[model samples]
Target: MASPHRSDDLHQGDPVEDPPASYEPVNSDDALPYDDYEAEHRPPPTLRLRLAPWDVISTALLLTLLVVLATATNWPWRLYGFLSDVCTGETCGLVPFGVDNYIYPVVWGGIGAAIAAAGVGPFVSLLKGWYMSFWPVLSLTILMVSSVVGDSLTLFSERYWH
Candidate 1:
């Protein structure tokens, strides 16, 4: 049976954290146990996203990349299409926009990837208890795939499908 719990785990330690005198599980119809409350608000069910150190770092990285991409996609260099069009005999870096385009996309992509690997990936692992399954890698892959394919999909939809 799913174990009943006290709502005191929020204090961090043991499964049973109620006051010694009053730590009894609710009498079926009275006050609920601490575990019940915890289960109700658990970060997320197992095999799901879990916040972790990498998540924090990756989130920061993604945010930074977002900033860089936004910055480069504008004026002066217009680096949005830089890396995408690089070495393709097309005007990627300094032609359509400028020199900023050449380096901006790559930098932003790196940041985006890092954010996925570090932030989103780890959080998945954390939620799934990293050891329970392959959450870390799986989560990272999900984000990586999204970032990589998202660009192409956006372009295709806008240019061809739409």
Candidate 2:
């Protein structure tokens, strides 16, 4: 004979029961406010600025590199000379396409400004509490200053030394 208390026999003939009268179905109207829930669960925005030692050091090194490139190298002048020489031949157009005196400084300055922006802009923004959105104006200012300095130095070297 089979046992009467077996698990299979216990549920074999049981009927489904209805929920109690006190029980109510949950709906959107009964839920907690979304804004409150989100505020409680979401993380707070950060206002602190963090910089690693390496980040500072690297930015300094990059600035130093830009200074060295701007002051030590005559590559801009050399490039200008080469480009100017290329246009001297008859095969070229009758109109001279020689590089202008003002061109290389602007080019070099623009290049230096770009390098500074890419490598050093973040540290500056972090320190000053400014956004990188101002990079263009900063870069333009750098370009103007660097171009003037570069041109002056090149002219001085050409006049006195060479």
Q: What is the C-alpha lDDT of each candidate?
A: 0.47, 0.53
**Could you give candidate 1's per-residue lDDT for residues 42-84 as a string of tens digits?**
5453354454665556555655555465466552143233335
How well does each candidate superpose onto the true structure, as a TM-score? 0.23, 0.34
**lDDT tens digits, residue span 1-162, model 2:** 222433433444544345566867588676455466545544455566765666556556655664665579984465344333322224433322332344455656576766678557776778766554445445545655665655554454343222
Deviating ranges (above 4 Å) for candidate 1? 1-83, 86-117, 120-135, 154-162
Which candidate leads the pack in TM-score?
A: 2
Where's the lowest-lDDT run of ten residues in candidate 2?
Answer: 87-96
With candidate 2 superimposed using the best TM-score fit, by how many Å does residue 99's alpha carbon deviate from the native?
Answer: 15
Residue pair clashes in candidate 1: 5-35, 6-34, 6-35, 7-34, 7-35, 50-127, 54-118, 55-119, 79-101
